[model samples]
Target: MAEPRPRVWVSQPLIDAVIEPLRAQVELITTDEVTAWTAEQLAARLADVDGAIITLNERVGAAQVAGATRLQVIANVGVGYNNLDVEALSAAGIVASNTPDVLTETTADLGFALLMAAARRITESERWLREGQWGQWSFQTMLGADIHGSTLGILGMGRIGQGIARRGAHGFGMRVLYHNRSRLPEAAEGEVGAQYADFDTLLAQSDHLVLVLPYTASSHHIIDAAALAKMKPTATLVNIARGGIVDELALADALATGRLAAAGLDVYEGEPAVRPELLALHNIVLTPHIGSASLATRKAMVQLAADNLLAALNVDGAAARMPSAINAEAAFAARTASGDKSKKR
Candidate 1:
């Protein structure tokens, strides 16, 4: 009798060209629509599959994985895996991977675009024009902040943050200041033309400040009322990071009261359901989470995730070839110990 092929599940509707090829090698279970899977559904679906490819919308945790006896790997299409309980996955000996580098430049482009929009009042001016308010052009009409030769501050100096720094310093002739948990080396800083600053300094001195940090417990509500008060009142604040990083109510208050000049956001604390407070304000530019939404970049992300899923399932080689497994080492160690115990029994 021949061995049954590994069964894999694709949790969301993905680019067909990138995901369809997996069908030839494995018994593929796929969804054609974007489904909001419940915890019970995820637990039941995962119980029978050996591996899964998921997007950020699906949250997998201890309860979801409790009955997943045959599950071995999960490949996440986005860089941020806050939706996945990594600790639980590691404890269960299930390796997890995320697509990171492929989306860096694309996301950085969106961040800079948002900064320019907020600084120049692009979207707000457009709305004004659409409302027939541009019939007479006044000298003070839509006066906004300058992007060139201004101080650009970045809260997290990761790959995306450095990309923004390069654009600001080299392309726009702006001074770039970055605040990170750790400072970069001299050569790396020179390449991006970025200077390291303390967090408060980054807020007070920046004409335009962008947040690119990951979301952790320590980072939640990092930009609250107190933090916003530290910023220059005329500054532009942009957040392309996780929504929880900024206090939404505080941000709305600042924008509404002119405590801050203008703001732009791509992510929200409760996304796809933005607050009426933010929508009612004219000084803010809002966009759905599309940081890595370019066609080329999104395809690259799905392809990388497919590669990770295939490698982790040992489709062609050993289960250790996943390119970006977050917990590969620990998961493999746990699996090894479990196998040894089974053999002893």
Candidate 2:
């Protein structure tokens, strides 16, 4: 008898062209509709599968993997992997991967678009006009901030951050300032035309502030009421990073009371369910987390994820072969220590 083919579960409906090839070599189980899977549902699906291709919506941790003895890999469709407990996945000998570089430029484009929209009050002006309020044009009808020759502050200067910096410095002729855990090398900084600044300095000097930092225990609520107090009342804020970094209530208060000029947010703490306070405000621009929503970029993300899943599942020396495996080394170490050499691919 032939050995059973590896079982792989796809947690959401992905592009058919990107996913169809997997059926040739694996027993592919897929979800047609989007699902907010419960923890129990996650564990149950993982229990019998050898691998899974999941999106940001699925949160997996120790409990989800406790019974997933056969599970070997998880390929996350997005760059951010906060949805997965990487430590737990590594300890359980499961390699995890994500699509990163492919979406960098696209996400950066959206971030800058949001920054321009909020700073210029583009969306707000359109909404007012649509409400038939633009009876006549006046010089000060919708006076908004200027983009060029302004100071642009960016937090968390990674690839996307660098992209934003380049756009601000070279394209918009803006003064670019960035704050990160460590300063970028002189050459990299020069290339992006950005200067390093302390946290407070970045906050105080910026005409437009963009948050592109990762979400972690230390980063959570980093931009709370106190931080907001430090920013210029005329400054515009844009968050293309995770939502948990800002306090929604405090942010709403700032916009409502004119403590800050305006804010553009793509991600929210409880996403798809924005705070009512934010919804009621007109100064803030809200988007449904479409940072990398372009067709080409989304397809690339799915393709990269599929490539990672297949490589980690069927390729010889799977760990080293995965394109963007996050915890392959640690996962392989755990497997080796457990005397699971027979299962090592």
Instruction: State TM-scores per candidate.
Output: 0.97, 0.96
Which pairs in model 1 have colliding backbones?
Answer: none
- lDDT per residue as tens, model 2, 260-341: 9999999999987999999999888899999999999999999999889888777433534888999999998988899774
Q: Candidate 2: lDDT over CA atoms?
A: 0.93
Candidate 2 Cα errors over 4 Å, as ranges: 316-320, 342-345
RMSD to the true structure for each prediction, in A, is 2.0, 1.6
Question: Which regions of candidate 1 are displaced past 4 Å?
Answer: 318-320, 340-345
